[model samples]
Target chain A: MRAPSKELTIDEVLGRIESGMTVGIGGWGSRRKPMALVRAILRSDLTDLHIVSYAGPDVGLLLAGGKASKVTYAFATLDSIPLEPLFSQARVERAAEFREWDEGMFQTGLRAAAQRVSFLPMRAGLGSAVLENDPDLHTVRSPYDDQEELVAVPALNLDVALVHMNRADELGNGQYLGPDPYFDDLFCMAAREAYVSTEQIIDTAGLTVDASLQSLLLNRTMVTGVVETPNGAHFTDCTPTYGRDEKFQKAYATAAKTPEDWAAFHERFLSGDEAAYQAAVTAFREEAQA
Target chain B: MSDVTRSEYCAVAIADCFADDGEIMGSPMGLLPTLGARLAKNTTNPALMLTDGEARILRGTPPLGQSGDVTEGWMPFRLVLESVVPYGKRHVMMGATQIDRHGNQNISAIGPWEQPTRQLLGVRGAPGNTVNNRTSYWVPKHSARVVVEQVDIVSGIGRARAEAAGPAATKFHDVHRLVTNLGVFDFGGPGHTMRFVSVHPGVTVDEVREASGCEIHADGDVPETRTPTDGELVLIRELLDPTKLREREVPSS
Candidate 1:
């Protein structure tokens, strides 16, 4: 009755995307990114995208592939590995437009969209170069207190938001089994449509275990499509369940340093289907164990 | 038996960044900051709210990257952001790609806005953190490129500039200290300008000037940064950072 099971294939989820649309990729730094969905996006011919993310590999891969025309993010890092080298190189070459904001300001913009507001006023950007760099941003003095000048961060409404969570029900109730949920729900809420990929799809009864997942759950109504992709957020961490594949991440970081290396790395890891990628991972793990 | 490395001295200087604070949440970004916060928590400021790199507000200073089966209680990211941060009771020591005389940090970019020549991380909570809590900086490699005349982009608001913004910005605007590989600095100088507090064991006043791109106000004899005590050395080596990752940051001969 309630649009019964919004489940779709990763391809179908990616098909919902079009070129020249603002897409928000969910996750924090290098953790819990919707990497499988990102892989599908990468495999497609969708080019000149405007991506908004708390960037990890999704931004780096997109930028590296030259699919993204612009990127709006607070920070772009691979966490332990630090700077996404490809993104750095791309920026140095003037490859893409960067609309950088303070993390709180960026999150506040998402919050503004989620609240269906045009803009939200905050003091985060006043003393910083955020307002100076962006000519479009305007400040409004508080009515009650004339001296308080707050920078108005415009709402960031995305065409689509892609997020990877620990688990979700068939009904699209997403849950994160990590310490930091990291504004995944806000990404869903700020987007016109949202697709979530999860490690597993449990029953509705399993959604709540002693109310542990209550705060961690993304409302099913906001989620348009759900795909069950186990070990979905690999390379980037899923946490508690599994830490980042540091070896693989190191390989990617190293390979991404040069164009020739990135191409080989992409062909070996990203060019293939998710199954092939998983197999390669298995092979790598076996070799490492050996 | 042997002398402590420059990296060890740098860690002690970083720890001194939090030595004065009574009881507050310390979120030290990067490896050096992490070591500094841990060292401070274990030694001087036991009241520091230390997280076990997971959920719990750790009572004991556990090893870095240790997770689960050890935490005292749940202190989710939500609680930290919403409650801890807003309370103005947090001290964050983060990296600065470029920092000016006024302590204005640039972790954002190097060139123009539309197309920066070299883009680093975005502002990334720097504005809010600097505005909301006591913020310090840790620069791994201090040179002219790092301590510049003017930062290309200001991610974190410095002392004088934050004051100029107004009382609203000035209330929580406290840029306490900046610990570098070469020396320690603070904004307590004239007009809240960054002043050279001390140099490391082997570093000299001339070395600090040679490294600084901007004019660093140093009136009196700049003392050598305090070396880590024997106990601190043991604690840092054994419980805090067993892997000796700090050595890799600013390696000692």
Candidate 2:
């Protein structure tokens, strides 16, 4: 993996993503969501995309915009975060198809892909409304021949995984500051290409400081291309310099209660240049501080 | 015909679920999580929100708590699907060991429950998930410990500097409800502080007063929890069972 001769803006990297492409977004619930990339996508023309994520506002925006053609994930969620209107419309109208799996089973299915398996089996989908509605979810008989139960899920192998690491070395090796890997390793390994978005690209000398560091690396050989984007993760991302500001989130949750509201909120927050966003949010902070 | 196919069964079961009784804010606790899940949906992503001409209330199994029971250990069926896990669920009822007048929660550890100290489940998903997920809280015991000042460890997301230490920090997200042993509370006020919404039946105002740790917008005559609708009961029965143990089929006598 050679270093890029030139640096690029977050938007430059995102401009190349195509429609119908399977994308793996790095984040679990709300921690370390690739905010920069999500903002770029929100402002991009790639309206039809297939995404995979654990949960966050990034997925919420795409799903709301009708940009997401499909999504395969272990959870569709918001944590303490306000609701997303797009998901509501789909759920009620039955426009979006959901495949059911238990919490463990969802991880197992992704593991199957990371391990390059064709499918995974579990007793998660039983008695689920999703199981009743989704044709993609089917029952696989237990091989043990004891209690015949329904268990089956199609293996998810992604085209590319968009990951934002806390810090990454030039070689693409990275470290996360939060609890676990936040589903990035599995999502990346399961995909054909892994596109990393890092807060900062530092030297690799500090790699062995933590034991888990060695365990998380998926050799450069497996990674297709590395794109260095700073502040690439937003809202959901955890960058060391700036912590999650409650004032901002409360405001965002308040302002963006619906798609129309989100569009307006985005215009107020996401649509502007970084300077404007910084100024607006900083002004908001100042007001709260005062 | 399947039990759910019968509308009568569904309605009766839902009604029983929302009946307010002795088990903590038992009744409204039954109703609100489902309501939160549905209402929170319209609030989160407005673009896809549906205000269908008809006002319909979708009674979903709110993650934990079985159809006719109250407890943890079960997640709602809506969260099972991979796609649903990522984009479907926006809010959830969190269990708290401690809370504040503002809707903050703490589930880190316990003290003198039996021994002098109880090492509770260390904020398993509370740190990142609480803020990242739309979180409300239900504290079974209404006491000083359950309602406290600043918490020991802010595991869930918060507004001031939560998850701000950088990518590693995910302590602050949303803190919505604080349903105590006596009543229901909401935290959408200034600084997102918790406020009393309603109290359960059989709970006197003094009982609620004695139980709450912080200031509450107490209601003199709180109403009883509505009966759980049949649709909600069906959703709960077929989807999430709080104990995690699957329901057993009837045996022929």
Candidate 3:
């Protein structure tokens, strides 16, 4: 007997998420992200989201749209643009709660959650301000003779995990063609459910034909649903499929200077469906060339 | 030999950081440090491993902004965080938004951590990099605002903080040299405070003191920063950075 297909629409994926649920977004700072699903969440009435990510524009967008109430992240940057303007603005204004951890500690938290462990010990945040800033974190001493102490990074379990990939099948086996798979697999494993948005949905056999076998980052068992959304990681780089839209990203960064500018940008690019947003981006590119 | 620019001097000083770092990974963040790492790999430290800033380990040091011939190994982000970082087999030179006398660095926010006046990159990898591996800093422009008495946030663990963390944290926690445009500094002074090693050719000790917010020890006679050799100058100009991007970073006075 064969397994059942788990294909889903953008709306159906968003339907699974509720208010104040912890959501883990995969990708490292302005790389492949599930922007289409994020866009749908923006258009919907979901509020008070507890967003977790090795953040980029997704955190900025959620903060800008008032969708997230708190954010747990290692850093929030747009790569080219050093600081994400909206997220920066939110921090300056103290608009939302933030639980900032060290990069390795953040990864350990996810690993702990994936492994079904309460916490993991590491040396990343031992005497740094991360422990001082967040009072919740504690240190643990080893039971051995050496009795070394380390930071007890708690598990960052998630209600849902959203990720974007190069290719996936109807049965939700995700594959990445980029140079780095990042921590996308860890995010999926750490969550109660995982939905992957991919550039193309091909036959299961076709995934291994051209790509190396190691590129298959996510197995079908780990994934709950797969949505085929072409160019789903716009503004962020999707690697061999396409590079980041630098012009659009610059425009996005510039528009965050003021509320009036953001409002105008919202009217032009956002405040519409995925098709409308894509169409506006096309128009934006044509206008720039002209 | 042609006149060596301040940026070139800074690059050579950065290269000297890895002169004896045999087979460990060298991760340099910005343009100047990238050039320095490549220069070190090409000339002095051939065994120093470098990555393509994404995944693959370059077979040999390539020129700036171009992928080299091939990769010797694959070091993706997952492997980097899981295997490479924890193993303490890497030396990283990262940028600092602000640094203090004790070498506590900050690339997080300005003002209070609760509500920052200006938010920078939020403590990205500094904590892990400092605690888990050999770390250094590259400050392109040194000023009172950057070289502070105390950092707003301790993104990277400094000498004092490492001492507080006890023996286990101090084992791999080596906050080495800090290379700036004006001079090179290290935490070797009394009480492990920042100490001035040398000044750039045109720069003076008074100028460095005036620019710094913290007390930089210059007890003995200070020396001028070493200029690159004719061969090194050729490698820097014709091979490594043909585009002259280093000029944009540290412009000639």
Candidate 4:
């Protein structure tokens, strides 16, 4: 018998998201973020989300929509672009519960969760105020050595993980053609359920043509569902497939600077479905060309 | 006399931050430092590894934003963090919003932790990077505000604090240098205090002292930072950064 398909619509993936649950969005800052899934959540009435990400517009959108109750991230940047203004505003206003960490600590925490462990010991935050600020973090003495103090970082177990990739097979096997796969596989393993959205869906055999591409593939067993989302990581980068839309990103960044401009931008771009958003972008490009 | 710009002098100072550790990764954050690392790789330090701000480690400098960049091999984030960082085979030059006399740098926040006056990028990877690798700084503008008496928060642990954290943290706790537009500073003084190494061509020791928020150690007469060679200048201007992005950071005089 053939295996049951693990394919779902973007709305179905968004339906699984509930308020007050920890959600992990895969991608390094402003790169291959699960933007379609993010937009679905933005459109939905979901609130009080505890988000975990290397962060991009995913953090900013949730914070701006007043959907996030907490955010645990290493950084919130648009990479070569300006900083994510909404998230910056959230930090200034004390709008969310913060569990800030070094990038290594955050990555290790995910690895621990993937391994079904309670915590992972790391030396990253030992000498810094990171340990002082996070009261819950304790120093674990090495079993073998008496002279060592390693910070015990907790496992970041997630309810759902959202990731966008370069390609996927129908059975949820995903591949990234980009330079860095980052911690996407770890995020999938860390979460109870993982929904993968891809720019294209190829046959399973097509994934193996290049040995380099095989290294970028995510295992099907860990993926809960797959959604084919062409141009999914728009505005943000999706490298090797397509570059970041600089004009759109610039406009978005400019809009995020103030409330009035952000409101206008939200209506023009963000206040619609993915197709509508695409149409608006097409219209803008045409206007620019003309 | 040589035809060296202020930016080129700054680049050489940044490049000089790295030790002659053979075949080590040089991950410089901003534009000038990036160009500096590539400059060092081509001219002085052939073993210095460089990337085109991505995964593939470049064999030669490539024009920024252009295709056809030559790659030595791939060194993605996973490989770099797992192999390079853990083994102390990497040197990184990062930017700082605030750095103290003790070298504790802060890029996370501007004021109090609870109610920050300005919230910058949270301690991204500084903590891990500092404790695991040789880390340096590139301050475009060096002033009392940028180099504070004491950092509001320590994003990267300095010498004294790293030493106190015991053996594991201190094993790789090498805060090498701080390359600024005005001068080059290193932690070579007593108790690893911030010591002014050399001033830029136009900048003086008095000017550096006036700009510094705290008492920075300068034992004797400081000389000018080394001027870039003609070949090095050619690589910087032509190959590494054809757009002349370095000029924007510290304008050529």
Q: Highest DockQ among the candidates is held by which one?
A: 3
Tell me the lDDT of candidate 3.
Answer: 0.92
The residue-level lDDT of candidate 3 at B181 comes to 96
Q: Residues B1-253, candidate 2, lDDT per residue (tens digit)?
A: 2332222222222223223211211112223333333222323222222111112212333343333322332222222233332332434455666766644455533442112133333333343344343455655457877777555434344444332323222322545556554566666545656555655545566677676666665435556443444545544455443332222211111
Clashes of each: 1, 61, 0, 0
Instruction: Between candidates 1 and 3, name the one with more favorable TM-score.
Output: 3
Q: Tens digit of lDDT per residue, candidate 4, span A108-181? A: 89999999999988878879878877787787888884567788989999999999999888898989988888
Q: By lDDT, who's the top model here? A: 3
- DockQ of all candidate complexes: 0.60, 0.03, 0.85, 0.72
Better of 1 and 4 by lDDT: 4
Rank by lDDT, highest first. 3, 4, 1, 2
Poorest 10 consecutive residues of model 3 chain A by lDDT? Answer: A122-131
- Candidate 3 recovers a fraction of native contacts equal to 0.85
Tell me the TM-score of model 4.
0.96
lDDT, candidate 3, at B28: 95
Q: Give the distance in Å from residue B44's predicted Cα in candidate 2 to where it truly belongs.
A: 41
lDDT of 1 by residue, B196-230 (tens): 89998888889888988988888688888877889
Tens digits of per-residue lDDT for model 3 on B1-253? 9788999999899998888889999999989999999999988999999998889999777788887658899998878887888998999999999999998999999999999999999888888888888888999999999999999999998988889998778878899999999999989999889998889889999999999998998759989888899888999999999999999999987
- lDDT winner between 3 and 4, please give it: 3
DockQ, candidate 4, vs. native dimer: 0.72
How do the residues A1-290 of candidate 1 rate in per-residue lDDT, one tens digit apiece?
45588889988898899999999998888999998988888889999899999888889889988899998888889988778887788888878887778777787788899999999977677688887877777877778845677778899999999999888887788888887788888899999999999998888787686448454569888899999888889989997668898998899999988879988888888878888888888998898899
Arrange candidates by TM-score, descending. Answer: 3, 4, 1, 2
Q: By DockQ, is 1 or 3 better?
A: 3
